[model samples]
Target: MTSSLRERRRQHLRDEILAAAQALIAERGYAAMSMEELAAQVGISKPTLYSHFSAKEELVIAMATQAMERLFAVVDDGDPPRRSALERLADLLRTGVQVQMDRQVTAMHLWMPEIVQMMKSRDESLTQLCRIDAVVVDLVRQAHLHGEIAAGLDESVVVRIFYALFMSPNVARLSLVNSPDPETMPDAVAHFFLRGVAAGKA
Candidate 1:
């Protein structure tokens, strides 16, 4: 019981730290954000925060990884996946777009140069990213099989388009036309995935 309680406390602290780091990075970008401010925002002393994360880079890595874990969790709900492949694909896009905007950050901000280099250097992280890509590719195939995606479009083309849509939110910020708000963007992207944009997808 004591060990369990200690583990719970540790998990709780880690969660709080990750959240604080994400918020700070979102508001100020990782480069400009200070560790002291992050600690203060979380109502913890610098030493306490350091105990959880040895350095700002480590905290940034952990925060980013946790966000990806949550993204993966959205799709990994069951053995066979509780949702249809198309639905899961949509969910993944939606979650990725929503969290970044809601937290008020950009994809580039989260993926800074050193952080990108770090992830690239880590074999495990690369494998995880590739696994996600494979899952998404499988979903595109399933979508085609179900007649959900347009026929005659190359599977590779459809997959590439889907990947493009995942990053559409980053582009949406620059649009002067009717851009979907966060609440509506997911459905809008799903529509665009199934139907061409000219077909009146939001």
Candidate 2:
């Protein structure tokens, strides 16, 4: 009973900390939110926060992993039979991107530098990212096989190309210039992926 109570309290604290961090990120930019401030916002001591997450970077990584898991769930839960693989893939990508843009883009941008560093330093995170890439690649390959995408198209090339187009311009804009025009990004990316890379019909 004691152990179970401790575990419940631990989970509660962790959830509170995450909630505080997210609220702070929404209010101020991610760069501006400090660990001390986060702890205070959560009504926890600094050491308590540290007990849950060793550092800000680790906390951010955990947050990002949670976000990715949610995205994967969205993709997995999508209708497969009713929709063509191409349509399903497009819907998944479009919906996933839009959800991130709406829900977590600011946090993502704020943590990107640290996340990139984490990816380099942590093999597990790198592996997870690769697995996510493989899922997208498989979708492309299946689409081609089913004739939903053009025959003879290189799936690997298409996956990489689409990944680049989806992540680059929006992320760059969020970092360098300003927040992206959210209205157009999803449709634009879906159309680009569904259509040929060249200027042609989708």
Candidate 3:
């Protein structure tokens, strides 16, 4: 069914608000982002912003939830034995990194203690995150079975480490050399992580 004209306009504004929120949260940590600032940045009144999102936490949760929904849709599961577990894992990592780059924020931002705490109360956001983690856990197990990951590394630890690598932008900032080009960061990061956890490397 087609959306009514008013509904379409409302959704367009909602998308605009979420895009602004992503950039603001990327520039300032979520703890520092304010609804008032977001409203002003979007050229909307506070009441207008509040009309779409009831609260700051709700808005942030909506943004993060949308992100996870996109990630869930695009990540390949490497079904039917077409790819090695290692290959599949690398693809997943690259997709995730590329997503953060596109959004100008990292998953690490969403995993911050305060954000995580806030998200616990948002069932849809929490569920989407769990779904992503579940896929990662399965991939890690498959990698281990295929002798791709280093022997004896705990699956949970590997999974956590995989998530931690999403913070590569912070690490890149501290580098003496120039940061990895955004175009190559996905492959560079995926290679770095996979090599670190390779069967004989760990």
Candidate 4:
């Protein structure tokens, strides 16, 4: 095949493999998934699957990276003047939680141990994560400087606390069991955080 054709074929195959893996993860938890089953589901040979992803860990990392990219895109597209930075930050957190509740997202997180191991071995993915973390931290800091957050609050601590709130098991449990509307969760989190951080409120 021509180089262009080869590249297109490769892209198509990768998409198929990712789709199959996501479906499998949704049907059966990530722990139960297997590369062989994924290859079969993608209608590709094991060797072909290996060519695309080498191992299950690489595939999961790619999936997570894709999800994070989507999340950042959402945050980037947010309207700023209409909403405070804190509101935008809350929106980002809510987006992260909703992504986690998603089957593909859950699969990625469920497979995170192996993913972290892979990052340890390769070392590149951690850099990407750090870059993303820095951006998030900066956003929080800017919010405080802009008076969107109280002056006395520690930006770093507030950012960490915001993340913790999203990752809290109670929030995840509420998301999974109650199936609370995704749109509502952000507002709720923002309200709670804002009240605590409001200027002159204490």
Candidate 5:
């Protein structure tokens, strides 16, 4: 019982650290966020922060891994055949954007060149990103097979389009535009993406 309690406390601290890291990364770009500021924000000593994550790169890689794992969970939600691939893709994109909005960041910021290069150096984080790509690739292929997407459209191009739409910064700045309400922003984005990539009637 004592051991379990200690493990839980350790996990809780780890979560707090990750949350602080995300907030800091949102406030300042990855290049500007510092471990000192993170430790101060989390109310933990530098030594304690070091104990949880040996370095900033490790912490940010862990953050990227966690974010990918979260999206993977949504992707693997066991209802693949019940929904259209296009619908599932849109929903997944919506969830991704909503999650980033909740974290006070955008997908583009989290995936800037600096962060992407660092993530590439980490095998675990890279693998998680690849898994997500594979899933999206399969969805794009399904979308093609179902005639929901243009038959001649390259699957790779469609996949890239999906990422591009998902990475739009405008979704995070809804209030600044004459756009739909926050509650409906996800739906609006999904609709916009779908229409742009629809099979016909362009």
Candidate 6:
């Protein structure tokens, strides 16, 4: 019982460390989040942090891995509740944007060769990414078939539109022309994206 309790406490501390790292990465880019800063932020010694994560890159990759796992969970839930592919895709998009803005995370940034290489060395991160791509493309096709999107628009174009609108890192300033606040920015972008693909919408 004592050993089990100790393990649980260790796991809890590791979770706290990851949470701190994620928050810092949101405020500052991954490249800017240092080990010393992370340790200080988590209120742990450098040696303890090192024991949890051998290096910064490893921690960042772990973050990406967790993000991807969550995304897959979102994607998996879509079709099970018998939701339309379009609705499923929208849920995925909104949650994805929230993850990036709030948690400073997304597999999108992991496409870099250095990071990709690390992920590839893991439990098939590349395969997981490809699976996500396949799911997105399939969803686009479903939306097009159901006339949820504009007429005559190719699947690729629709995919690009969805990604461009949903993947804003600095989203607060996104509506400079229309002058919407950060809170309204997400809805505005969603409207624009959907409108472009919306049937009979100008």
C-alpha lDDT of candidate 4 relative to the true structure: 0.70
Q: Flag the better candidate by lDDT, 2 or 4.
A: 4
Query: Each candidate's root-mean-square deviation in Å?
Result: 3.7, 3.7, 3.2, 3.5, 2.9, 3.8
Global CA lDDT computed for model 1:
0.72
List ranges where model 4 is wrong by over 4 Å. Answer: 75-84, 104-121, 168-171, 174-177, 195-202
What's model 4's TM-score? 0.78
| Clash pairs detected, candidate 6 | 149-197, 150-197
lDDT against the true structure, per candidate, is 0.72, 0.70, 0.78, 0.70, 0.77, 0.73
Give the TM-score of each candidate: 0.78, 0.75, 0.80, 0.78, 0.84, 0.74
- Winner on lDDT between 1 and 3 is 3
- Please give, for residues 1-202, the per-residue lDDT of candidate 3 as tens digits: 3579889989999999988887888789677889999999999999999999988778767766776666676554345657777777777778777766666554456645777778877787678777888888898998998888887788888888888786666566556997567798999889988888879874
Local error of candidate 4 at 199, Å? 3.5
lDDT by residue for model 1 over 1-202, one digit each (tens)? 6999999998998899888788777688778888899889989999988898888878766655765777788777767766666667778877776665564454545545667577666687767667778888888788778766655677788778777887677677567987557787777777666555111233
User: Which ten contiguous residues of candidate 5 have the minimum total lDDT?
Assistant: 171-180
**Model 2: residues >4 Å from true position, as ranges?**
1-6, 78-82, 104-114, 151-153, 172-188, 196-202
Candidate 6 lDDT, 1-202, residue by residue in tens: 6999999999999889878887787678788989999999989899999999999877878777777777788887655557777777776776666555545343345444677688777776768867877988999898888878778888898888777766664343344554234455556665666667777889
Model 4 per-residue lDDT tens digits across residues 14-111: 98888788788778867799999998887888998999999877877777776677677856676554676676677777666666656434533533
Q: Rank the candidates by lDDT, best first.
A: 3, 5, 6, 1, 4, 2
Candidate 4, residue 88: Cα displacement in angstroms equals 3.1
Better of 1 and 2 by lDDT: 1
What's the C-alpha lDDT at position 193 in model 1? 68
Name the lDDT of candidate 5.
0.77
Preferred candidate (lDDT higher): 5 or 6:
5
Provide the lDDT at 104 for model 5.
Answer: 53
Give model 3's TM-score versus the native structure: 0.80
